[model samples]
Target: MANNDDKSQSKNKPFFEVQKVENEDGLGDIFFGVDDETTKFPDYVVDFKDEIEYFISVIQLLYGDTKSESLYKKYYERLFTIADLAFNSPQEKVKLAERSLHKLKSELTTSVGQRIRTKLLMDYLKLAIWPSIIAIIIVLLGDSVLTCVLAFLGKGTENIYISSLGLISIAAMAGGWISTATETRNLAFVDIVSVINNQRGILVRLIFINLFSIFAAILMIAGFLKINIGGLDSLQIVDSPTVALAFGFALGFLDKVFVDRVEAKLSKTEAK
Candidate 1:
């Protein structure tokens, strides 16, 4: 019985020892050698509170020195944690997450208000990027596949098809950046007002983006019109204006699908 108890205790000792090592390693990674940078750890209990107060004071100072420093650091930390968890995360979201983290790290400092400003900027950037990237992928797919489908269906012009792809890329980027700006700044009349004084600016920019998208679409369509109208022999299919119209309508349908996704996100956010 005594020998059995000794063996059981020996087995438990290794397990507990391994757990303690793991916990220490985790703490060390989080602090990232900050323990070496600071002075000797205080001996007494009150020191922990004092250290926290000092850290807060440093953060406040940095925040004042930099633009949205505290917010930026917070955003950076949050996004960084997400990245760490999803290191093997799909390529689709990895770049976006990395960009946000990089922006915060590059723009922010640990000293004071700078971290806050950086955090805010990072979050704002994310709002613009996440949707825009998804939109870009959709636009790219719609342009490529839809164009090919239209051509097969006797409704596409090569010039128009190629131009649509380019136009969609530009439009998607614009929409993403603009939406991010509005979201990050929390726009006027929203629950969290991030852009308190830039209401007019936001509206003006949005108007310009919408007008620009229209112009780009027209330019692409016009380019298609310029393509040799005499190439009927090469394609061999009878070109019907109705077919062209139908193809245009199909593209519009894709746009509606994209809009629906945006609306759903908005609804979910509002509900939250």
Candidate 2:
């Protein structure tokens, strides 16, 4: 009877030892290590030790930086619990522990990524809001605002070409703003992350739109591009200031398509 009890106890003994070491803050750390009898450990137990150590290191790195301390602490505790189970539990239960740890790691990583993306988006909005507002105002006011500035400087405000140029530039800015707004509204989480990562691209895109708008407007003014209304053949785009302003707005609104077409045409010309 005594020999049978000894054999049963030896068979039920765990492969690893877990010790609790308290920090200065009194929150203890779980020391998960192999037993002194190193040769008795199985191959899977060694792999679990390595993976759990890595998980602990990652948790420590993200603990203070994450927004919700309680949430992180919960995951930290769960990680150690899974490690303990992986080491101490029967061979059949080890796979369950591994799966749990993997799921927890995925959730923690996604949470951290989302928090980082949210911060980037907020910072971008703060920098972009004022410029967007100013652009919209300039677009709406167009030549009236330009005329006021020119009048204040005691310069002639009657030049049709000057007014047309101002109109084109401001209208282009408005078109770019509208395009950006629409794109932002439709963005998904991953798309937003990409946008936030490249915030400077938004400004660059607006600049391109303005440049293309101005270029197209110049072509119209120079008689290289013509618009003939179906019934009113007498009213050409270049002849009237009102028509010029509307045409500039259209060019600005369709800046991307216009630019692409221009590029394709240039590429074909080069091929020829």
Candidate 3:
């Protein structure tokens, strides 16, 4: 009982006390959060009690002593989105702050348009690995699924021509679905709000990716990847359009580690 009482007494000591000063004319501005009453917050700071500390901390962490109106507007928009989310977890705000800081640092030497494009590509490829695999499975399953479509249309599945009808439709749908779920994690409204809105460009790239993956899968399944082990053909695992789809999906998902970034650098070099 005494130990518990002592702990309670210690906690009763204020983390901070709101400061106020008295003058003959009136009372001075009261400080509610900071140690000193004169400490003022940036206009971008959100007023939510749950997030106020985090917002202030992030502002200080990112800007340090060098504050700017541009940063204020940026942080204001981001903080507003953080407070608007349904679930108020601090982790999301912290993650956003970290990424924003990193993005700002990386963009220091890049032109404005180039920086925007880079940021978009980075977000597009985030959390794409396993999701890409799932998308490939959907595409590969397309061939088998065509039989069901044929049966529904009163056609027999035994007819090879009928089962192969609308052959590429399933792969297209799988790519579309992958683009839809690329949210990655909770972020500010403006961050990834229209991640797939550039539909034509995205679809074109994904199509190329899918084609390349199919090509690579054929070689790999044929023992072309040069593994000397027996029974290690791609058909031993990735047999149909569904299985072959994995290679293309991997290409897109691993674009950062593969062709996309390589192409980007080559373009930059050519421009230079």
True-structure lDDT of candidate 2:
0.61
RMSD of each: 19.1, 10.1, 18.2
**Could you tell me every candidate's TM-score relative to the true structure?**
0.26, 0.43, 0.27
In order, the Cα lDDT scores of the candidates are 0.39, 0.61, 0.42
Evaluation by lDDT, superior candidate among 2 and 3: 2
- What tens-digit string does per-residue lDDT give for candidate 2 at 1-272? 99998777666667777665644544445676555754576677677677776665555554644364675578668877887676666432567787887787677656565564455455545654665566556545756877888899999887435555656666666665555555555444235335554564655665676678777767666655444434322124435656655665666667777777667766877899
How far off is residue 104 in model 3, in Å? 20
**TM-score, candidate number 3:** 0.27
Q: Report the lDDT tens digits of candidate 3 across residue range 56-94.
A: 344433333334546645554454443333113322243
TM-score of candidate 1 on Cα atoms, chains taken together: 0.26
Q: Which runs in model 1 stand beyond 4 Å of their true positions?
A: 1-120, 161-194, 197-217, 220-272
lDDT of 1 by residue, 214-247 (tens): 4434443554222122242212112333333333
